[model samples]
Target: MGGGIQWQQNPALCNIMQEPWEEPDIPDVEAPTPRRALTCLSDEDSQKIYDSVPRTEDVFNLHRGDLELHEKLGAGNFGSVMKGVFRRGGQLIPVAVKTLKQDELPNAESELMKEARLMANLQHRNIVRMIGVCRSDMIMLVLELAPLGPLNKYLKRACGRELTMNKVIEIMFQVAEGMAYLESKNFVHRDLAARNVLLVNEQFAKISDFGMSKALGLGNEYYKAESAGKWPLKWYAPECIYYFKFDSKSDVWSYGVTLWEATSYGAKPYRGLKGCQILELIENNRRLERPDQCPPGVFDIMLRCWRHDKNDRPSFRDIVELLRKFRSKS
Candidate 1:
C-alpha cells in the first residue's frame, strides 16, 4: 500500500468568460454522496500521526504513518509523493498521498477545492481514482497508487530504444481513449502533459490530476471577455493562447504536445522557449517538429493537432480511431 508524502509544492481558476458543456439539465445525478463515507481529519489532533506536522493553530497533517509511507516515490515542486496503506474493514488499502506544504501555493486551498470537485465527478478507466482527501488546511489528495509512475519518466529510462512502437502506441492509445471519454462528457482536461499522465502497470495508462479539467459553455460571459490569464505555455495550443479559451479541440491540441513529449522520451515540448516566444512563433504559424523516433502516423496526428486554426485540429474521437488503427498494426 502507498503511504505518507513529504512536503513538495500548487491552479488557475475557470476563466469567468469560459462556458461549460451543455448537459441535458437534469435535476441532478444522484450518486452516493461522499460526505457519508468521508473521514474528516480536523485541523487539530491529527498531528499525532508520525508524518503529520503542525499546519495551523488547530490543524494537524493527515497521512498514513511514515513507517508505512513507502520509499520516496517521486518529488515535485509541491511535495514528495509516497506510498502508504490505510486499514479499512480489516484490509490494508494502498494510496498515494500527495503532501504539500500549507504555503506551497498562495491559493492552495482554492486550487485544491477546485481539483476536489473536478476529480470527484470524473470516473474513467484511463483516469486515476481519487480515494479521498485529507486536510488540516494543508492538503493531501488520497489518490490511487499507480505502480508504474508516468510513461514520460519511463520513456527517459527506455535508453532511446526502450519501448517498441507497438508498446508506445498502446500507451498513447490509452491517453486518447481517456481524452475521448472526457470529450464525450463535455469536459476538457486543459493540462494533458506527460507529467500529468501516469501508468498503473506497464500497459495501463491513467490520467491522474484534474486540477486543469473544467466545463464548457457555462460561464463564457466572464472568461470570454479577452483578459483571461495565461496557461502553462509549453503545453498550450495556439488558439488557446490567442482566444483565451478552452474546449475539447483545445484539449486535442494539448494532447498533441503530450504525444510529442512521449515521442521524444519526455523531452520538453519546446525547451528554451518562453510563452512570448511561442506566441510569436504561433502568430507566424510556426509549429514544433517531430522527433526522429516518432512514428510517422503519430507525428502526423500531432501536427494536425498543433494547427494554428482551432477547427483544423482533429477531434479526440478521430485521434482514437487513428490510434486504434496504429495499434492494430502492431
Candidate 2:
C-alpha cells in the first residue's frame, strides 16, 4: 500500500491578496480572427482579473529567460501545454508550461490568472503543484510535471493489463482525499473527472485543470453561476444542471463518474447519449449501470453519490472514510 507516504502540505505557498485590484492597460496583439464566435473579455475586464492576483513572490516568480521549451504535451481550445525545463537556482527542473494561444489571449488571460491564484494557495501532494508564473510574451504557468499524463488516457492505454484491483482502488482513494481537501477549503472544482485527474505515476494521481474552479464566498453553501457555459452534463448533479447551483455535492457526483471511468478502464460516460437525452434519463431516475469489473461495494458508493437529492449524497470526507475501509479489506 502507498499509505505509508504522509500527505505533504506547504503553508508558505499560500499567499494570495484579498484586496481589490485595479485593471491595467494592455496593448493589442495582432492575431487571426477566430472562425467561430467566441465570447472574449475587454482589456479592462481582463486586466481587472489579472491585477486582482498579486504578483508572485520572487521565489515563485520564474525568469522567462531561464525556461527552455521542449515537446508539446497537449493542446486544448484556449491554449496548449508543453513539457519544458526551467533552470532555477542553477538546477534544471522538469516542468509543464501552459501558454495561451495568441488568438485566445483576449479571452483566456483572466481564466489563466484565476487558475494561478487558486493553485498558489492550494498546497497538497494530490493537487498539481504550482511551481511559478511567467509573464513575458504571454502568461505562462509553471507546474510540476506529471509524466504519465491524464488518468483517463493512462487507464485507457494500460487497459487494466498492469493495474491490479487494489491499485485501482488506491487511485480512487487518492482522488477522494484530494477532493476532500478542496471541500475543506470551500473551493468548488467545477470540473472533476478522470480526464482532469493527472497521473504522476502508477500509484500517484493529482487533480488538475482548475480553470473552471470557483472559490465559494464566506458562509455560502453553494455558488450560483450567472451564465450557463459549457459544462460536463454527464458528471453533474441534478441541482447543477437545473439551477446552475454547484457545491461539494455536485463534485461528489462527478467523483462517482470518475470512479466509474477508473473501474471500467476509462470508458466514456453515456457513450451514445446526448445532453438532452441524459437529462431525460435523469428525470426518469435512471443512472449509469455498473461497470463490468466494479465490485458491489464500490458500485453501492456510486449509487449513493447519484442520489436524486444532493443532501442525501455522501460528502467527500465520508467517501474517503468509506474507501479507506474498503481498501483495508481489499
Name the best candidate (by lDDT): 2
Each model's TM-score? Answer: 0.73, 0.81
Give me candidate 2's TM-score against the actual structure: 0.81
Clashes of each: 28, 0
lDDT against the true structure, each candidate: 0.63, 0.75
Tens digit of per-residue lDDT, candidate 2, span 149-249 = 77777777777886766788898999999999999999999889887888766677789988778999999999887654455667877677566689999
Cα lDDT of model 1 by residue, 129-162, tens digit: 6655666535776666665576776666663564
* Residue 204, model 2: Cα distance from true site in angstroms: 0.7
**Model 2 shows how many backbone clashes?**
0
lDDT (C-alpha) at residue 131 in model 2 = 70
- Tell me how far candidate 1 lies from the true structure as C-alpha RMSD in angstroms: 14.4
Question: Which one wins on TM-score?
Answer: 2
